[model samples]
Target: MDEHESGAAASGASGRLARYVVAATLVRSADGGAVVAIVLLAHASGQPDWASGLLGASITAPHLLGPFIARRLDTARDGRKIIAASALIHGTFLGVAGLMLPVTWAVVPALLLILSGMFGPMLTGGVSSRLPSIVGRSQKSQRRAQSWDVASYGISGTLGPAAVAWIAATSSPLVATLALATAAIAGAGAVLALPRQSPLHDPGTVPSPAHTLGSIWRFGPLRRTLGLTVIVAFSVAVLPIYAVAVAPSLGDAALAGTLVAGYGVGSLTGSAVLMAWPLRGDSDKLTSVLAAVVAAALLLVIATPNFTTALLAFGAAGIANSLFFAATLAARSEYAPLETRGQVFIWVGALKIAAGSAGTAVAGTLISGASWLPVAIVAALSAAAATVCLIQRSKGRT
Candidate 1:
């Protein structure tokens, strides 16, 4: 291509990148906010805590079926179209949820919301798989792309709940639910804006979802990456407890929220660093080092007596967690075969959600019985397990 054509191409890709970031951030922020809003709405309607729990489960439980949905997406003519359709349908469900007021149509709303879960994986995994297309084969460009994606996802996870709380407090929980429905539609519009591309999978080579799952189960590097991801997910899940332990010494329990917020900020910083100086190393080695750092950071948090030290440690842990997340994604994208990429990304996401759920339950239980010390030990053990997996990957055992 001539200089002018090359310049134009670069400009076009840059614009698309910006759009991708905005759409992803909005969709994820809405997801985070909507999850909390669902529980809040359920409670406001006089439902028990179990009912709230059920509502939360309706959203995440569909992740288990992600491989199946991803397999279908892989076989479709236009992945973007599928993703857009799913987002639109999900938005419709969220709108129906907003209308199910007065608490009488609770069961109907729950089922509709549960069905909505089916589209989430498709939307997220589809976007992720398209990253390679957007950034091309250059390692630095790809790293920047992934970092942008990771940073946006992490930030959204933090901001989404806060947004929900603000909207619910300032207005009403019903309005917050309705807002998520609107956000979902907006995300659909973003997906529709992308330029058309061919399918990511070969039609004849596509396997059953069961076969895809089995392949991922047996693949060594992918397995190790998933294991490391679980560790990172669990580490994040325990942040609230970490905040609780540190906030009292700072003269206000509210200060503990800063610890949680610090982690989010740290993730943004890490992503920025990666974008500026992309890592061109083995993801296995990177995962191992980052996991060890996170473990040490958690241990430090447990030992630090002052709130300042604890806050710093948590922030460091968050930075390492973000880098670790990027490494895991790189490992999968580097090694996962073309036909199985969608399924792998889908399963990885599912496992992370499951790990986060487990971490929350474990952290809550352990902290109740033994405080943050035992929780730290549990977190350290998870990190250690991830380290072992990374080591195995390095040894060519994966």
Candidate 2:
């Protein structure tokens, strides 16, 4: 292509990526915020705590079927429509659930929300899976877009919870829920702006779903990358729990909220750094090193002599965790085979939600023991995950 044509292509890719990033960020913001808002709403509504628990579970539980949902998306002529549909569905149910919680609808709210979450992948990794086709598959184009895309996750994570809490505090949990629905609706509109892409992958080459799960093992980079993601997800699931647990020792029980906020800010910082300077060199090595950083940082949180030091450690852990995730995203984009890429991304996202849910359960049990107990376990998990990745890397070289 001539220089002018090359420049035009670059410009078009940039415009498309910009829209995708916004839609992804807003959609995810609503998704995570809804999870938090419902629990708060249930508590405020004076229903049994289990009512809120059920509401949250209803949202995440459907993600387990992501592989199947993603297969249908893979075969669809335009995946963007599915993405837009998911956002609309999520927003619609979320708004209705907010209204139903304080009224007589009762268990029906969870049932309705479940219908929306069945399309959950389209809100997350399903959106990400389109980045290569949307942004152009060239190394430079893909890397830049991947960095921006992962950074959007950090932005959404931090924004979602913070917005929900602020609105819930100033207004009401019901209001916060309604606001999240609006964000999802806006995100759906932005998603429709994304260029329609025919499934870039070949369906004929895909194997049975059982072997697809096994395929992660055969792909060295994808295996290590996603394995680390699961371990990190587990540790992060314990993050708020341990943050709250450690607060009393720091001399103020109120530090719990501050420490969690610190971690979120640190995560945004790390993601911003990568967006500014996109990752280079061997990604596996970078991921392993980041995993060790996360472990050491948590250990520092455990061993610190002062609250200030402990707070810094929390920030450090957050930074490493986000950086590690960005590397994971790049790995998935680079290594996941073309045929089953959609299903792979979607399944990986579901596995993360499952691991995180399990981790939250285990952390809750262990958190009440000693303040140091849960943090120590999280650190150990990070360390162990790194070791496994290093071993796999060595084997891959052979």
Candidate 3:
């Protein structure tokens, strides 16, 4: 290629990356804000705790049918347009919910909340499935893009809650809810600004859902990676317990918050570092190695008597968490059938949510009987088992 053409290509790639980052950040930030806002709004309106749970359910319940929604996107001529439209509608519903929650009948607000949540699967699944197309097919480029995507989640997770708390405290929870609703609409505008692209597949020949799902089951690598992902998700469910566990040991309770926050900071830092130093060898191997390292860290958290030692270990585990996600995502992109790519992404996401829920439940039971150490031990053992399975599977594949 000519030097001028190469320069133009680089510029275009950078521009696209910037645009995608902005759009992703907006959507994720809104998600973070909405979670806190929903609960706060329910409480401020004199609704019961169950009402807050209902609000959360309205959002998460959509993931059960996420694969179908993702399938619809794969078959659409312009998934980007679908994403923009959904974001707009979602924002409208949230706006109505915000308005109704403060004054109108509770039923109306509840319905509006449910309606708003119906579009979440489309927004998240569409964005993730489209990353390959947006970033191009190069492995190194894909790794960087996926890392950035994970980093975006961490950033939004941090900022979103803070924004909600600040806004609700200074203003009103309803105002905070409405503000996040506006952020959703802004996210739609950002989606609209994304460069146009061809559909994921020919709409005429888009694989049936059954075929796509069957294909996922048949692909050994995809199957195992997904299984491992669920295990990882389950293992991380008790991460919040770490803060409680660390407080007594440290003699300074505030150190517990710092230790917990270190995980996110480490994840963000790891995303950047992994972007530059891409993992070598098989992606599954990378995943297994990461899982093992994370397992070791969790064990340290369980065994360490010193606060500093446990804190550093927690940070290392956090970095592994991010790296494992990047590796697994890259593996999915590489191995998933083109016709079923969207389904795979949606399925993985749903599975992670379910697995995390299960993990949390199990940890709660264990912690009630004993303490945080038992929960950490359970999580670590689960991860170690997954690592062993991956290593054995890799060996068999060889």
Candidate 4:
């Protein structure tokens, strides 16, 4: 390629990455806030605490099929459009739920949320799996992009809950729900401005779901990456618990949202630090170390004497979680075969989301026992999973 062509290509990639980051944050913030908005709405409506978690679960549980849906996108001419459409559809459900939650049966909104969640992949893995094509083939460029992408989740995580909580505190839960839902529509518009692209398949060369799963199982390091992904995500479900059980008992209910936002703020801080001085190592190995760090930080939260200390602990854990996420993403990409790569991202991401849902359900039940019980169990499980991943790494799995 000519020097001119290389320059133009780099410029284009830079531009695309910028737009992708902005749009992703908008979409993710809406999706992330859905948990808080729904929980608060349910609680405000006088539903049981378990019902609040179940409602969040309703939207997230459908993430199980994301990997297969990813294959469908792999065959599509342009996935961004589909992803944008998904955001719009999901936002619509949240909006409708907001409007109807006051007068309609809770079941009606629950059903809407379930359908909305079926499209959840677009929010997480769908856009992420496309980073390679967007950022070009350079490993450095891709790593940088991954940090930026993870940072979006961090920003969204902090913004989503804080936004909803502020609005709920000042206005009402219904208004917060509607406001958050608009992010999806805005994200759809941002996605359409990007360049057109071909499908991942060559018309008829798509792999089967079984083939994709086989690839993941065959790679020891990749399998470990996925396992740690689940454990981290499950522990992260403490978001709702902070809102419903822990923070409120300590003080105001708004503190629950504030605590959740602290984690996100920590995520943002960690990702920023990584981006400035990017890590260089076996990503698979990095993942295990980061996972252990995350678990340790969570345990620290349990020992904090008060809300201020708990927030700091949560932020520390958030930073660790963001770093772990980047390592896992890199490991999965490096270890998985190219053909099934898209499926791998969505599949792993689906499990991550599903695990979080399971955590919410379990946390709700355990909240009645002791507020610290859920955090304790989650931290222990994450620590165990991190150790297992490290052992596999030592076995020369990478």
Candidate 5:
């Protein structure tokens, strides 16, 4: 085939892969929501808070391992196989977990950890690998594609939580889990249908995953982007806690659930906005400014007494989140080589998970003893510090 014809064929395949990737990601989010409901059920069944926290940790802990595995397996040819396998494994585990429900708290967490470990890398690797094929050699197209991916994530995130709420309210948590398992199984099937060929690879040079990660880290823009991403993750971590703290003011615990759902909705809207107008300027600077906005919005969330005001504040925070995510992903894709994109993306995922965990734990503890305002203030300060660091790093890069 001629170059144009070859490019057209590759683009067609990449578009199909991107759709499947988005579907897979949505299914993964569904699984995550089911896991969250399971943890909540465990707590309701008289499990200790610490035990529930452990279960939550189990769901997230595999993020630490995913990058390491991606580093080893994220090559041009084999990465798709790894992704497909991971999806199968994830579906299998989810099925097993569903069958074993109501067995013990310990078993639930163990299964969740195994499922997460397998699924995490697959999700990140699949998306990152497709970037080159979708965007080709155009820098502008790459940025737009990154925004599109973030928009997909935001949509999935909103739907997942809503699905959890619906399932948990009308039926049982087990039923919710079963739905999640079904989604996972469907996603695995979709992955199996993806085109086997990838366009990101150069036949002459195959870079090691570690080298790819190192290159991404060494890039001035990416490094700054990571810093800002940490802030975004940290701020997001505090959100659930903020919902809990504001629950009393809103009149009930159920309102807390609504608040969280509202945040997701806001995020979905924000992502749509970004997709419509993808970030184009220096991503490093844009990320910092978004971080500052997130900080301000978070503080507004905590300070507001009424539900109406709180919803608006949280919505603004969600906008900040969408902006930050789009810019960071765009910048990271620009800075990282295609061969090692999976590894680079996975490392960023790891950092986001770690920062989020720390932020949630710290925010939860602080809110228990001190006022919510203090937690908000601290979170804002942390965001501000991250923003300053990002700005300084960007200046250094220039």
Candidate 6:
């Protein structure tokens, strides 16, 4: 082909890749928004603290199941089909459950928890596995893909709560749930548009799911990456509860909402900053220090008695979280084998879910006793653990 024709073809391919990346990102954004809406709906329905706990549990409990399911399904006849099917089923079920049941019904919360948990790994693993296919195998390409995913989530985190507030105010909280369901449907559509099987997975070679996951665990780099993810999750767990704690003190629910919005704003800023100028360094060292910084920020929130200080602290925490997420994912992808990328990614998702659940549950119980010190202590410990893990990994590498 002539030079012009070749250039035109290359440009066309780039455009297609960009579209896929954008679509994947939008899907994730909608999912994040939907999750926030579900939590808000549970609260609005006057579910007791136990019920709310269950709602949170339900959303996260899926992480435990993620590794097992991804292991089995990753070797299935069609990984993409499995992902698309899961998304469609999750969306439909969630929508119907939200529409039919009142907030007080225990069944609704249970169903939401189950659906969300099941959907979490399927969606996350599917997306991460597919990334290498849409973008090239180069580090730069992978970083771009990861950045797109993080950026979408950052935007969703900001908009999701606002959308929930607006919908909950004007109409029923069910409206918000329905909106999330719509996003799930769109996400499924995006998955369907993808090639039948991810190029990351070889059609000719099938490894035992157990072996696949086991290999990921054996890889020092992946293990360190997962360890950092756990710490990130623990630090993040503080944000939701912190927002709730600060709400009553502000004398307005809207202020609490604004606090979260501020965090979202900071998250967006952080992600943008990362994308504009990505981090390049020793992944283990970089992630450990970032986790420590985030932990320190959380401590500031706990130490400060004033609402203004708390707000600033929370905003800074959000920015730290955004950077940590981008950096962590980039590190994970780099260390993972392409064939088993989905399994590794799912494992990270599972670790994060477990950590967040544990952190939130513990933090909630502690804060109930009117003490924020315990919250800070837990965050500090988690960050410390993450740092130690990374340091050890660095040492081993040397």
Query: Which runs in model 6 stand beyond 4 Å of their true positions?
Result: 1-14, 34-56, 76-78, 103-105, 108-116, 195-213, 246-254, 303-309, 368-372
Model 3: colliding residue pairs: none
lDDT of each: 0.75, 0.82, 0.74, 0.81, 0.67, 0.69
Mind sharing the TM-score for model 2? 0.93
Model 3 quality (TM-score): 0.91
Q: Estimate each model's TM-score.
A: 0.93, 0.93, 0.91, 0.86, 0.84, 0.84
Cα lDDT tens digits for candidate 4, 9-97: 88988899899888889888888888889989888888788878888778777778666667766667777777878889889988897
TM-score of 6: 0.84
Q: Give the per-residue lDDT of model 1 (tens digit) for 1-398.
A: 99999899888888888888777776766666667888898888887889888887787777666667777667777767777777788778876875784456678778877777766666565567766766667777777788888877776777778877889999988888888878878988897777665675457798887887778768787777777777777777887775775577667889888888877778878888777777678776777777777777677767766777777777877787788888877877887778767777877887787788888777777775545765577567767776687667668885
lDDT of 6 by residue, 1-398 (tens): 99999788668647656666555554555555565666667777776776666665666576577776775455666666777776776677767766654634777657755866676667665576666666666676567667666776676555655676788789977898788677777878777676555443454464555786667667776666677787678757867776787677767656776777677777888877877777777666667778777787777777766678767877887888888787777777777665666777777877787888777777777777665755577676757776677667767852
* Deviation from native of the Cα of residue 88 in model 1, angstroms: 1.4
Per-residue lDDT of 1-398 in model 2, one digit per residue for the tens?
Answer: 99999999889888898888899999999987888888889889887877778988888888787677676666667777878888898899989988998886568888877876776767888888888888876676677788888788888887898899999999999999999999999999998899887665566666665677788867777777777878878887787888788788789989988888888888888878877887786777778778878888778777887789878877887888878877777777777877767777887788888888988889899977887888788889899989878887887741
By lDDT, is 4 or 6 better? 4
Tens-place lDDT digits, model 3, residues 65-178: 566666776777777887887788777888788888768777787777777776766566566777787776777787778878777777777777778889999999988888
lDDT of 4 at 120: 78
TM-score of 1: 0.93
Candidate achieving higher lDDT, 1 or 6: 1
Model 1 clash count equals 0
Decide which is better by lDDT, 1 or 4: 4
For all candidates, the clash counts are 0, 0, 0, 0, 0, 0
